[model samples]
Target: MVAPLSAWPWENLGCFKYLLYGPFLAKVLYSRFHDQEASEYSWCLHILVICALRGLIHQIWSSYSNMLFLKRNFRIIEHGVDFKQIDKEWDWDNFIILQALIASMASYMFPFPANLPFWNTKGFIAVLTLHMAVSEPLYYLMHRYVLHGNSFFTHHHSLHHSSPVPQPFTAGLATFSEHLMLAVIIGIPILGASLMGYGSIITIYSYVLIFDFLRCLGHCNVEVVPYQIFKTIPFLRYLLYTPTYHSLHHTEMGTNFCLFMPLFDAIWKTLNGKSWELHKKIRSNLGKSGRVPDFVFLAHVVDVSAALHAPFVFRSFAALPFSPRFFIIPLWPLTLLALLMMWAWSKTFVYSFYKLTGRLHQTWVVPRFGFQYFLPFAREGINKHIEQAILRADKLGIKVISLAALNKNEALNGGGTLFVDKHPNLNVRVVHGNTLTAAVILNDLPKNVEEVFLTGATSKLGRAIALYLCRKRVRVLMLTLSAERFQKIQKEAPVDCQNYLVQVTKYQAAQNCKTWIVGKWITPREQSWAPPGTHFHQFVVPPIFSFRRDCTYGDLAAMRLPDDVQGLGCCEYTMARGVVHACHAGGVVHLLEGWTHHEVGAIDVDRIDLVWNAALKHGLRPVSSSC
Candidate 1:
């Protein structure tokens, strides 16, 4: 457990934690209405603006580092950040809030008047000189002697070093004491410049932002600085540090203790001898391609808000199970505009990834939303994006790709049949993963169930469930409008079991059945026909609401990923931590089982049980029903 002082006070508030700045915001509004002089409280507003700009800089670096497309080839650490690391660093912006508050209080306490000039060349030179002479050595001595040499400070510093693989935000993940010390190291030079009578607004903004920018750059875990320049000048290497240089400090813990410049380390004889060599080695591999994934789960966005839940948007928020926050309501219009842009120009891109049992798995989003698939004009565009993703995966030697959710909707792409039929020679196995979906739904049913009610009985999952249950001598009341479609599915079962697959067109026909298998969205009126205590087992997208309080409803077919899974930092849709929709798991099982055939088109009834058993064999547990 973390010590009370080690954690931020507002950590648990989530997005609403921004309300800590409410007083400053209220001040800005009050000044605007009262037509107050710009000099009176303008610095207060400037402090808030600078704080926001600092946050934006960190967010940009973080998002850039996490993007597989942009940073795949240059990743310093091959493994990704896990949920544990994300949780530990959830309050990364605490220091920013604290700094802003301190600055606000200092404004009134200090004798300096407001409206310092915009630019001060003498101030910039003075601060830059003082930073090198005073700030650099002060921080180096304090960091090496106190932070690492002393055990008390080391305990607080350990929180920053906890994440071995660093992202930009990792720079700010530290105990409150450590951050307070950092604020002092940064404050001395600015204070010295002011005491020398050269301080100005630009000087303050420039110095602090550069300090934060360099801090973020070192923790980005990507080698962006070229080695050739360092080789040519040699002295420049000590003036600026690379990501790999700082990364070595995290791993080794005793060397490279200088804040940003390594000159102090070189002068003190504490510089790691291999820093330049290692930086060159990592830089040499920058242009090479990343590894090919073994499995890919092709998915699409569900709605505007869910789009913000992507790993790149907000790492801390994405680490938790997805649900819209009250704070996100203000950003709704912006997200909607982003969606329209995606609809007009976006293609498939990698969303997130993880490694399971030495095999690489990734989720690739199709750049379309659920509602857009139902729009008739958007069908062709959606299918085109999916095809491009499939062909890209095949070209990269990916073994299997599972179509998730609406990406494989029967009405859109014929459950991925259109792609396979069009390109027969493709090596990558295309999978709808409905075999596991049917298995999860069927296994959730009561074993003693004599009669079961089924909705969307003619759909792919519904047909497989009806046929598989009929083999067990269970009666299936398949509700469908097309008698012809019902007869076609019944003929596929054994002749002796054909009578067990009965057809019914109305919800009233299943009033006596206590088990309801729903493949389509059903209204409360339709759900009313089920007997009390009925459990609705469903495979529908955006799962139906649990309107019957007296009854139970199972979540969409899903399975908990194996315990050994690594680098999975976000939840799949709204699934509990570590759980993924069954279709995504099916892709994993396909790679684990080494099956060569594509599990596309109508789900094979025979493979329903086979897939379920394989998932269990590999430690993927089925999700239980809940009210």
Candidate 2:
């Protein structure tokens, strides 16, 4: 899936250096009065041109194959998970130069005939047979001994072992010393052919073409070779190597050391015995069409801390420089500054929170803006950042994104209508995630409670919660910017309980309130404000962003996420893993139910049971605690 092109660290630099080195090499060789050779400038030009074309073909073909798979089936390929790093294939660009050098060895120009017999013309058939015979034993020796025996060479060899699924360019990517050794290995066949008075440039070119093609095929994930053909010619199955055979050398690295032929591996007993069975299974699955997922959930929050753990941390901000043109001045500029500050402090992974379930479902944690500093001061720009994060989810093939914390406030009147309006064609749905939030809080409402304090009582969630609490015949203490806004509350709140609602400027022990609804970032810092036996139901982005004077991590240690919970709002605040905010718990509920459509604001009291029932269907139940 596309996770934004800017997300990759494909090092396409240093192309011009080689472009310049071509002329330099030709001049130096000419001055030394060396034997005549093909013009280096022409050679570099040809190599660079072909390399660029081949690179395009590789990217387009691989991406198309994946897209075709995803569209027809439910599951994405392993490489498609986070968009596999381009590095493995990208390092193989140097091979184009080797091809150019081999082409230069020709006594004449290219586009040579393909079907000349072994005794007639180039004698490639005979040379290819001899080369394979000689190279197989040498390949086995190099791989089994020198490559693995020497710690220095093994260091280079270990890189190839990193990716379980090798790609087209994976064959050529190696350290310079390793490349030199590999060059000598290839040179053996060429030098021997030249000395034997047979094999010309046509032989070398044909051999290189077939050799490169076969190596690429060895890494390609497709298992198109017919099983029946191998069965019919049992000896042929043992004679020729398949992609599955080479893949084992990467995954089960101690086995399958021989290349092209399985003779050495058979003799040495290093051939992977399980490859045949595995290949048959893969081929069988490919024939069954594609595997689709159940659902996709994306989490959007503004967390700068996670950005500190990214690989190539500086590269994470590569798009920030060009962002100002697309965005208003101060917004993009401020975000750029914030990213720099975070990086200066050694932050990383502001990239993405990638995870997939055993059920083949997908989930993502997408960060908005750079950090918390932009959350308030750059509020206008924050929406764009939220949109961008959702857009990133769209690129990741996620179908829905849940707005978290302050990000929820940026949605259309907090309903996400503005987001839908801006991007009408977006595949990833914008979810406010408030329905589940309301469900968890109401489900946990304490019985026999006559009085309750609502901190930030006039805020959307707080007001809805406060008014609902009043409907339950519970006395509500409304703590707002202005307690006098009681006129608004009196107008909106239930008439029978309006008189029970107290407008308070400050918390007083005399209120005798045993329960409080802590707002976003609100903490009764003074111990007197929260009298002994006072319990709170915090429902903020981080339900425990702050704590009262007497509290510690240990004080809130009893909080644990319910069985159905995944994204815990209090995750960053606590070392304990299971603590969740009433907000994030809502998203988890949606994920558990496979609901894709947006559910915003509070669920009506009458319909609260519907949400509760859905949660129960997913094996979820409220943790019955007032605090």
Best by lDDT: 1
Q: Give the TM-score of each candidate.
A: 0.93, 0.47
Compared with the true structure, what per-residue lDDT tens digits does model 1 show for residues 114-173?
Answer: 646677799899999989998899999988987776664556788888896899999999
Q: Residues 1-627, candidate 2, lDDT per residue (tens digit)?
A: 322221112234454535633643565457446644434343444434544555554443343333322222311134331223333444555555544455455413432222222333545655665667787788788888877766754456665555544555566665545555565666566555655656555565556556666666676555646667677887786677777677777777788887678878889888889867766655556565443332334343344433322212221122122121322343445545756564354311222222233333333333344354244555555556556666666776655566655656633235566677777787766666565556566556577888877776766667667777777888888876674566686677666678877777677732477677766455445335666666776565444544554432112112233443321112222323333344444554566666766665434555455655665565544545423
**TM-score winner:** 1
Model 2: lDDT equals 0.53
lDDT of each: 0.87, 0.53
